[model samples]
Target: MIHRPRRLRTTPAMRALVREGALTPANLIYPMFVREGISEPTPISAMPGQYQHTLESLADAAREAVEAGVGGLMLFGIPAHTDPTGSQATSPDGILNRGLRVLREAVGDRAVIIADLCLDEFTSHGHCGVLDSEGRVDNDATLPIYAEMAVQQAKAGAHMLGLSGMMDGQVAACRAALDAAGHTDVAILSYAAKYASGFYGPFREAVDSQLKGDRRAYQMDPANRAEAMIEVELDLAEGADVVMVKPASHYLDVVADVSAQIAAPVAAYQVSGEYSMLEAAAANGWIQRERLIAESLTSIHRAGARMIATYWAVEAARMLRNSL
Candidate 1:
């Protein structure tokens, strides 16, 4: 034959040399759920291998993740108390704040700590924002709450505040709060183009979310692409050091488009539902777990995600390091 495309795939060394995309432990950010009041961890039934940890165990988890070479850890709090205004979000004694302190102490700068700055976990209505008299989300009224939440996270020793609430002008509001509090060194990683999708179903279980309704009122619709670019621009203009797209596998186009349009670091979240799918397939022997995990992460990375928030961070990191 005149053309031999198989020549390049003939040897392992050749394949390795010609590989276009790569995944490493350094590119991963592990998401952890921390619950208040307990010495034992509770497993989330829908999401296998995921657990809600107490402060003590959570510190150990952070240490283990860092020891495994995971680059960062993302903290999500499952607060024990809830209120209309989510008053616990601004309290130093709140679960999220306490978890942040514990993780910061355990990791000791060995890994980057990014705290999920949202009120949903602490709010009685399980909405990301404060409700109006009509019981709908009030965007403007929520801004100050997020501002307070951001500052609290920063004060709790989080290196990066992950603004995942999807509220308009949230990034700017949090930035103002941080700067005003003299936390200029703390970075903001905004969830710029988060979509309202079914992929978040398992996550709701992971965090014990008491959501009464869908997040469509605030989160972006999956039908829109150009809107993602606008969200990215707004976040960047509002001083977001990083911007992210959620549910990375189904949204590579959004990730690539945002990466091309913005100068800041682009991140993608391979959320709980994504992990559970692969885990289920692997359990059924329909797919190879390790290989699929590596491939999925590599695809996100190749699509221009500078960082990936993944449930398989430690596992994928081990594979990548061992493969190297």
Candidate 2:
């Protein structure tokens, strides 16, 4: 009776003072979808509030996010055409590259702009990398293309390159390319432990992905947590400045484990499907929307994620600011 642990929970002020983890706007990165040659912001039906933004609209979006005090932004492109080799990924006029240019000019260093460096959006088949004649993801063949894409993103003024391809040696390939191009300052944020989970369903719609089959060929299986560590180690050795785990809520343990194992900064991506679920539930009066969003993000942060990429970045940040 003399030892009471409930003293800390006695009041809201006391709880705030004793809080160990927090979700701030500065820890949030807004993930945006940008398409080539657009006159209007195309609404993504699957992701209710998200859109495939035109270059001009994307600039306005970036400015709005900056005004809202979001820490960073990540860009995913939707190309008008796709080829076998995903050649558009390395072109300066590519949707992603142009979007990066627009964001850079609009934000003007007010926010960190990271480009999603992968071929899925540009490839005809919608795989993260190139495929062999048999349609298998050719890991080695994809590395060079990824490297080229990294340099192109840097050239377009991306503050960071997000290597989400999940291909072997992608980080090393990209690092070498950036160094060769004298873009030593451009950081590489590797999706080191991305799993082949069911949570990516809505994302395909958001990007208008032409994916024919699952991404299990390269993305990790959800059954193996230890394998994620191996991938993280490889990315770190290969020059990844930051390492990330995708589908954050379902893999908090993996994120925590990876954070413990790696020296690089750890990030968690709250994938589109995860966001949609929360939004749907909240719309149905199943859960308090703001509270649930903040709790989910707080859980990710508590799991040791130094940064979080989320569709609700701006909203979460606004809520956190008001709560403070």
Candidate number achieving the greatest lDDT relative to the actual structure: 2
Instruction: Estimate the TM-score of every prediction.
Output: 0.97, 0.98
Task: Please state every model's RMSD to the true fold in angstroms.
Answer: 1.2, 1.0
lDDT (0 to 1) per candidate: 0.91, 0.92
Backbone clashes, candidate 2: 0
Model 2 agreement with the true structure over 1-324: per-residue lDDT tens digits: 998989999998999999997668989999998888778999998888999999989999888888888999999999899988899999999888988999999997899999999999898898888888998999999998998899899999999999998999999999999999999999999999999999999998888788889998789999989999999999999999999999899999999999887767899999999999999998899999888888899999999999999999988888888888
Q: After superposition, how far is residue 176 of candidate 1 from its true place, in Å?
A: 1.1
Q: Which parts of model 2 have CA positions greater than 4 angstroms off? A: none
**1-324, model 1: which lDDT tens digit per residue?**
999988999988888888886767988999999998767999988778888999989988888899889999999998787898889889999999999999999997999999998888888888999999999999999999899888889989999999999999999999999999999999999999999989988988887777887789999999999999999999999999999999799999999999887778999999888999999999899998888988899999999999999998988888888887
lDDT (0-100) at residue 43 of candidate 2? 94
